[model samples]
Target: MAVTFYINLAYLLGAIAFVWGLRLLSTPDTARRGNILASIGMGLAIIAAMLAPLENTSNNYGWILGGMAVGAGIGWVSARRIQMTAMPQMVSMFNGLGGACAVVLALVEVFQFYGGERTLDSGQLVIVLSTLLIGGVAFTGSLLAFGKLQGLVRDNTLTLPKHNIINQIMLLVLIVMGVMLVIQGQEAGLTMAMIFTVLALIYGFSFVIPIGGADMPVVISLLNSFTGLSAAAAGLIYENNFMLVGGILVGASGTILTVLMCEAMNRSLLNVLIGGFGGGGGSAKGADGDQVAKEVSINDAAIQLYYSNSVMFVPGYGLAVAQAQKVCKEVDDLLEANGVDVKYAIHPVAGRMPGHMNVLLAEADVPYPKLLDLDDANSALPNTDMVVIVGANDVVNPAAYDDPGSPIYGMPVLNVWEAKNVIVLKRSMSTGYAGIQNPLFFHAKNRMLFGDAKDSLNKLVQELKNL
Candidate 1:
């Protein structure tokens, strides 16, 4: 009784830590502390769980410790080595592993019941089966997303003939199998569970493959929510309060983030799932068809920056691709030293994931207060003296406002064109992930600075120092 009481107490404390940690994660200032708190809470929960009574008489701790050591080593090494460019793929892989863990636990519970070593009520059985289904889908779906992001699988939408019909059929089959499993119970349900798992895995892969690269952030958010819900189901099966609370927090937060991302892109969740936004890289030719982009030399660009009183830096995936966040910060620091006010404009959907730009900039030691969101940055742009667009394209495109027939017509973009002078640094005039050209390049206020983002920023830093 004392052991049970202590275990419950630990779980309650862990739940509180998780809640506080999640609350702190809402703001950039406390995000690192929040992560540490959450890690500590998870550690406490794991320790408490290990101390609880086990069903079997196997007292061997070697296997468990060995597994923990291996997992910890791999995670440490991976986190240390992964670049910001591959962070989205890494997130996908981690979320998938969480789902896979839930699936494995569910399967183990079902097998134990089948072997007569344990007995579960109908409610428990249902929870276990549900966890299996949701976790299976999340696991396979996340792996496919990781593959797409890694360039191992094609990033473009992969659709079969009558894809919608096939998807519906598969879903129906899964539903039927789930019903059979529940009805059959302990006697004949094992086979049905296996069949359901297979169908769920296939459905997960099929669901994610049709999504294009532009929609990956939303997909990642949605899959994260799925994994959380699966974990919650696992918690219910085990009657673990800590896991239940943690899962609920993750599910709620992930769902909110996913909705925000969809809103940021001015897209509906259903439309994103149906998949067709980003096709091939096709440049839009509107009234700017005859307008030629004027290229500016690094020295000339530096002169503009040096004279400007206020500058806003807009970052995108190109910044990540060039691994230029550090040098970008160097430019900011140099400009600040010259008494220039510099700020970073962060679009909600910038880069491949939510908070991608924030994370990169944070690593470069950019001040949290200096990072402005879409609306805030837009408000500041009109009065700003200069806008330095570093490897950004579609986010600052004037076409989002001017072209009614464009694919990203209603999406909210940074109003960089509203600034007095705009200098865009890029290797070429290629379209962004949305595969659409940005007319902002041809705008009168904008000048193209064609080069690698890191090189251009380095040159800018050198010029600023010379000044």
Candidate 2:
């Protein structure tokens, strides 16, 4: 009885830590501390579980410790060594591993029930099967997301003809099979469960495949929710309270973020799940229209920035690729010293994942208050004298609002063109992830200063100093 009491106490404490940590993570100031607290909470839960006595359980310290050491070492190394550019892929892969863990746990319960070593009621069977289904989807779906971001999977290979219809059929069949497993209870054999797991995985790959690169931010978050839900299901099967609470928190947060991002894109949840939307269909007479984009030299752009009453810097995936966050920050600092008001306009889907640009800027020690979200930046744009688009593409595209026939039409984009003078820094006239050309480049008020973003930024800084 005392052992049970102690276990419950530890679980309660862990649950509290998780809640507090999550709350802290909502803001920039305390995110690091929150992460540490959550890690500690997880550690406490693992220790309590290890000490808890259970039937037919031989706690092999060597194997368990060895596994823990290896996993921890890999996680630490990967987290430390990974560049901000590849963060989305890393996140996708790690989230998949979490799902894989839930899969293993569910498989153990499934095998035991099928072998007659254990039995469960209909409700319990449903929970076990649910864990398997969601976990399988998360595992393979995340891998596909990772592959897409890493360029290992080509866009042409992502979808089959009429893939949407195929995905719908698979989903319906998976649901029917899950219901059968629940109804059969102990009567269901291992073969049925294995078939269900395989189908779920296939559905997962198909589900993510149709989504375009532009929608990756939302897709990754949704996959995270799937992994959390599977973990919660596993916890329910084992009656572990801390696991349940932590899983619920992760699942709920991930879901909320996904919905919020969809709203930001002015898209419905159904549209996102439907999946054919983001594959950019090249639009004619939009950004690809015959208007010639004007050019600006580094010296000229620097003079414009130096004398501007107010400036807003817009960044995109290009900024991340050039590893120019520090240089970007340095440029902003120089402007600030000259009494030039500077702020950064960050689009919700600026990079490969949500908060990607924010994380990169944060790494360069950029001040939190200087960052302006979509709404705030839009409202402030008209009064701004100069808008510098650094390594940006679709987010600042005028076609989002101008051309209804465009693929990203009606999508909420940064209104950088609303400023008096617009300067775009890019290596070339290439289109963005949405696979659509940007009309903002051809806007009468905008001028393109073509070159490597880092080189241009450095040269601009030199010119600013000379002036």
Query: By TM-score, who's the top model here?
Result: 2
TM-score for every candidate vs. truth? Answer: 0.96, 0.97
- Measured by lDDT, the strongest candidate is 2
Could you give candidate 1's per-residue lDDT for residues 1-467 as a string of tens digits? 88889989889888988999988888878998998998888888988888887555785677888999999999999999999999999999999999899999998997888777888877887898889878888899999989888878875546787776787898888877766667777776566667777788888888887778778889899999999999999999988888888888888888999999999988899888875566655456553447789889988988889888999999999999999999999989888988999999999988888899999999899999999999999999999999988877778877788788777788899999889999999898878887888888888888899989998899888988898
Q: Which regions of candidate 2 are displaced past 4 Å?
A: 54-57
Candidate 2 clash total?
A: 0
Which stretches in model 1 have alpha-carbon errors above 4 Å? 54-56, 187-189, 281-288
For candidate 1, the TM-score is 0.96
Please state every model's RMSD to the true fold in angstroms.
1.7, 1.4
Q: Rate the local accuracy (lDDT) of all candidates.
A: 0.86, 0.88
